[model samples]
Target chain A: MEPVLTALSAGTSVDVLIAALFGSAFGLVFGAIPGLTFTMALALVLPITFALQPTAAIAMLLSTYIGGASGGTVAAILIGVPGTPSSAASVADGHALTRAGKASLTIATATIVSTLGGLFSLVIMLFAVNLLAQVALSFGPAEIFALVIFGMSTICGLAERSMVRGMIGGALGLMAMTIGQDPIDGVPRMTFGSVQLLQGIDLLVAMIGLFAIPQVVETLAGHRAGHQMKIDTSSIKVQLPTLRFLFSYRWNILRSSLLGTIVGAIPGTGGPIAAFLAYSQEKRLAKHPETWGKGDMGGVIAPETANNAVTGGAMIPMLGLGIPGDPATAIILGGFLIHGIQPGPLLFTERPDVIYTVYFLFALSYVLVTILQLLGVRLFVQALRVPHQILALIISVMCVVGSFSIRNSFFDVGAMIVIGFFGYVLQKCRIPLTPILLGLVLGPTMEREFRTAMIMSEGSLSIFSQSPTALVFFGFALLIVAFHVVGSIRSRSAGEARPA
Target chain B: MTTPALRDRWTGLVILLVAIAWIIGSEYVIPSGYSGSAFGPRTFPTGLGILLAILAVVLIAGTFRRRDTLPPPAPSDAVDEPAKVSTRDEMWGAAATFGFLIIYFVAMQVLGFMLATVLLVATFNYFVLGSRSLVTTGAVALGLGVGVWYLMGHLLGVYLPTGMLGLGV
Candidate 1:
């Protein structure tokens, strides 16, 4: 109780408040623009957080995440295209309402439902994260190793269309992490006698490269000049839904929010999946399913709620188990590390104040995002008018600047470009990038835990099997892999049986 | 080569070769200092190399089986899929974007962040984006270059390289 009060005070400090506002505004703009994801925004903001206090920095990141999650609805309503992948489901009903001249009502309902969903998930996260951390506190080195392997397997299994490609991506990430000094022995592994290589790849630099560069190149290559979207701004006002109207769909809202939080808590699934699931469930349950694609308010509410709820749902694993479920949460994990806040079971025991501070800021961000989206809907709609080519050029400069600012190293900037090109090539090959990112973030921990467990047993492989906890995790990993393999084989055989 | 099977086969072959080379490097090139444990520094990399090899082989094998079982995609389907950059102009646009970045990196070392950024932005806008308004391009380039330099380098206390020209603060 005392820590919660202290954290409340810290969260409401002028500096933290300003940071939250700035981050929320920035994220809203970026999220409202097609092809500009909040992941990219988070990557750019990471270096700037170096100069801030930990609380303020985290406040900024939390607000940005929430703001970005909610801001995608604007493009879905105004442009007939989703600004982010999570909002893809929102476009069907959102644009339908816009064309039907009820844009104001849809936007307002989306904003309110998004806030409700975010807050609902935050409550779930507040309790669930602590409980999960308490349960994880009993885990030993072997258990942790097994758990991380399970996380890796799930990500590799679910992130790509092809499981083999995903595994290859994960292997590539692990291989990249092996370039620096050995963690336990302090012996250089693959530095090749270069002083810079001794520190290994900087996570921030690689993230900036992997997220920003591909978008820049694709935008530059694909953008048609002088293209402009004409939107009717006068009709796009926020009209608050009546309580009676919201009460009618209360069960839909609750169910979608719960579904989103659960999907977010999983290690591999993320916003788009959760949003689509919620939308489909709502459609299936509706008596008049025909009204779904043609401007039903429930359609906008279900997906918007679920996608925004993902922010809090994702935080559960990130803060409790040190596992990020998606790219955005992964970058948030990087932010937490940058501030010297190591997440996991120990974080709750050692820094309850920080955890409470995160909760407060997360709840606060929802209020701010709702207010900002309500007031500045027109301003954000105007932002979509900016040409993609110009935006790409600006991002190119930002990539160089952001990379260099990390350690003030020119070499890091060059490394970002190289890794970015490699990322682009991987994208061209249809290899998923998220698994590679997860592998990089989880590599050092996996290697360290595996080595420690080995030493504890004097190199006996049975150490992993001795612990029931470790065995459970390992069994889960195998089950996940087998499930994916069976599913893939069945799908292939089904496809083969069809007449061409 | 444009077919998914053909592309996967090529990608798998390349990855397989790279994985084999990585295994050799892990065994021969990486120094395994005695950590007084059975598992050495080279163990993880070697394991990753082997995993990559197995995955790459599976990928290649899957592509072959796919080729045998599946009919080819219709020409219309192939053409209808959005190309990343198929036109000549778009190809040049992609190449020029990369070329400009390489130039910016070199120029940042020689002329510093401000001048190099201005040059990169203005040239990219005029040449690649086909922006004809010199005044708008100049203003945007100068504003972005100077504004970012001031905000990041001066206000935020982040270091911006002054380079040989010594232009940045």
Candidate 2:
């Protein structure tokens, strides 16, 4: 109780509030733009947080995350293009409603439902994270090794179109991390006698490159033909849904939020998966399923609610287990590390105040995002009018500035360009980037734990199997890999059998 | 090469070579010494390299099996595929962007953050974005360069590089 009060005070400081507001506004703008994703926004915002108090920095990041997650509905509703992938499910019904002349109503309902969903998931996260951390507190080196392997396996299996490609991506990330000094031995592994290489690849620099540069290149290339759609925003205004209307779909909102939270809690599954699952479930359960692709408010509510709910759901694993479920949370994990806040089971015992502060700020971000979105819907809508090429150019400059600001190293900026080019090539090959990021985030921990477990057992492999907890996690990892392998084989055989 | 199967095969082959190179590098290039622990520093990288090699082989074998059953699609047939941008234009755009970034990086050292940023922004606006209006372009370039310098340098206390020119915040 005392911790909660202390957290409340810290989270509500004037600087923190202002940072939250700024982050939310920035996220909303970036999220509303079709090419400029919130992931890119988070990457850019990360450097700025270096100067802020930990509480204020976290507040800014959390609000940005929440706002970015929710802000996708604007473009999805108004212009038939989803600002982010999570809002792809929102577009069918959202744009349909816009075409039916209820744009304002759709936006309002999405905003309200997004807030409700975020808050709902925050409550679940608040309870579940603490409980999960308590369970994780018993984890030893072997258990942690097994658990991280399981987490990595799931990400590699599910993050991309091809499981093999995803694994390759993960391996590439792991390989990249091996370039620096060895963690335990302090022996340089692959630095090649360069002083700069001793620090290894900065995760933030890689993230900025991976997420931002491709978007910039794609935008520049694609915008040559000028595919910008002129949206009619003359009649758009915040039209709040009636209490009766919202109450009617209360069950749908609850179920979608629940689904979102569950999907988010999983290691690799994220907003798009959750939003789509919620959408399909709602469509299946609807009284009139045929109206779904048309202008059904339930469709918008389910996906919007679920996607926003992912913000909180993702935090569970990130804060409790030190496992970031997706790219955004991976960056957030980076933020937490930068603040000298090492997440995991120890965080619960060591810094309960920080945990509570996160919770309070997360909930507060929802309120603030809702207000900002409600008042600035028109502003966000106008942002969509900005040309993709210009936006790409701006983001290009930001990428330079953001990377340079990190450690003020020119080499880091050059490294970003190289990694970004590599990332672009990987994208062209249809290799998923998230698994790579997951590998990067988890690589050092995985190595340290594995080595520690080995030493504890004096090079005996049975140490991993001796612990039931470790065995269970290893079994889960094997099961996930086997499942993916079987699924891929079945898909291939089915594809072969089909008449071409 | 445009076909997914063919592309995968090429990618797999490249990755296979990389894996082999990584394994050799880890064994030869990385200094092997008597570490206190049983597992040495080179162990993880070597293991990862082997795993990558196996995965690359699997990927290549999958592509071969697919090729045996169906003819690879022609390049023209890929035109209708969604999300497949114009490769030529994309490559050119990427090259141009990279060139510009390199110039900016070099310029930053000589001209400092503010001037280098202005040049970079102006170049991007005119060349990349195709913005024709001089007033709009100049204003945006100056505004962004000055704005970021002020916000990041003066307000946030981030150390923006003041290079040989020393015209920074």
Candidate 3:
């Protein structure tokens, strides 16, 4: 309680509060753009945070995290572009609701429910942080390895249409991870003697390239040609959800929030999966399931709430265990690392002050972001009308600039372009990019843990078997894989039974 | 013949070759130090290579067996789907954009972000966006370029390259 008070005191300071507002505004603007994403936005701001006090820097980044997490819904609702990857599930029903001439209601419901979900998760974070920290304290290298596998196994559940392509994407990312120095030993692998490869591919550059550059090309090719987003703002009305309307979905919101928090607490899963899972569950349970893709208000609420809940859920592992729940959190973890803070069980014990500061700022960021968003909705909606060609050109140049800014290396720009093309080709083939991002983030960790575990066990593979926590995670991973294989076989037979 | 399945097969073949190359490459690389640890750096890459090869094979084989069906028609509800461009036009647009970006990146160091951005934005405005008014194009380019330059370099204090010309603030 004393730590909380201390942190809260610092959090409410003028400088920290000011930083939070600026970060939230930056995140909202970036996240509301179609090609820009939470990860890219955070990465771009990461260098600037270097100059601030630790608490202020983290508070600002956390604000950006909170804002970016929810801001994606704006683009998803208005244009179906999914401003950030987390908002992907929101697009289907969100855009449908907009077309049905309820754009304002959909947006308002999204904003309100998202804030509620975030607060709900923050409550969970307060209650569960200590227990989670205790659990993390028990993990060994083998357990960590199994945890990574469990995280990787999510690719199976996330795979759409084909698990094979998704797995291939994961493999590609893992291969990319092996490009730099081996984590366990400082020995270089796959560098091909290039000095630049010594530090490995910058994940930030790869992320921007993979997410932004392809969108630029795709926008230039497809969207501007005439397939532009035709949003009729003049006829559209923005109406806030009434008390009755908001109260009606109380049970659904609670269920989605709990589900999202649980998924978020897990090592590998984050917002998109949680949003999709929550949305699909609601869709399945709805009385009129046929209304789901057509313009159901429940559809908007479920994904938005779930994704917002993910903000708190993602922070759980980052703060308690030092493992990032998703790519955005991973980048935030990078921010923590840059401040000379190693986040693990030790963090809670050694820096309870910082932990409480995080908690206070994390909750406050939601309030600040919501206010900013309400005041800027008109401005943001106007952003939707900007020409796609201009957006594409700006994004392309920024991608180059942003990539170069990461290390001030031209080589990074080229790497981003190359990865962008690869991402473009894979996206065209319907291969999911999320798994690849997950793999890249977790691959090095997995390798290091596995090697460390083996060394401890004197080269015996049974170290994985011996650890109870590892066995549990491995069991979870196996169950997911089993589910995928069974699901694949069932779908294949169903296809076979169909009329030729 | 123009089915998505055929296209997938080609992609799978390319992946297969890459995976095989990855495997071969993993074996040949000599690390500077020999480790007494049970698992060396090669373990993960070798495993990933095998996984990639297996998946590629499965994908290619599945393509041969699975019946290729056309995608369902676009939903009438879609308001903002991408417009279709001809392959030739798409290539041209891509080349123009990519070409411009590469030049901008190179010039950013020598001419600084401000001047290079001005040049790129002006050129793109004229050629790519096809803006007819030179005055509007130049003004918009100069404004945006200098605005961002001032924001990043002056306000944010991020150091942009001061190239041979040293056109920086």
| Better by TM-score, candidate 3 or 2 | 2
Residue A86's lDDT in candidate 1 = 92
- lDDT tens digits, residues A1-500, model 2? 88889998998889999999999999999898887888889988998887788999999898889889988889999988898999999999999999999999999999999999999999999899999999999999999999989888888876666788889989998889888988888878778889999999998899888888888888777776456667877777999999999999999999999999999999888999999999999999999999998999999999999998888899999999998888899888989888899899999998999999999999888999999999989888888877777777677778888899989999999999999999989888887888888888889999989998888888888998789999998899899889988988888799878876
Give TM-scores of the second chain, every candidate: 0.87, 0.86, 0.83
**Models sorted by TM-score, best on top:** 2, 1, 3
**TM-scores, all models, native as reference:** 0.97, 0.97, 0.87
Q: How close is candidate 2 to the true structure, as a TM-score?
A: 0.97
Model 1 interface CAPRI class: medium
Best by TM-score: 2
- Window of ten residues with lowest summed lDDT in model 2 chain A: A220-229
| Model 2 interface Cα RMSD in Å | 1.5
Q: After superposition, how far is residue A181 of candidate 1 from its true place, in Å?
A: 1.0
Every candidate's TM-score, chain A alone: 0.98, 0.98, 0.85
Best by DockQ: 2
lDDT per residue for candidate 3 within A222-261, as digits (tens), equals: 6435556667556444578899999999987998898888
What residue runs in model 3 are displaced by over 4 Å at the alpha carbon? A13-15, A33-40, A43-57, A72-109, A159-161, A234-249, A266-303, A322-325, A338-346, B69-93, B132-136
- lDDT by residue (B1-169, candidate 1, tens digit) is 2677888889999999999999998888787767677787888999999999999999999987774445577667766544435555455555766777778888898888888899889987887678889998998899889888886887678888888978754
What would the per-residue lDDT of candidate 2 be over residues B3-48, giving only the tens digit for each residue? 7788888899999999999999999978774655558899999999
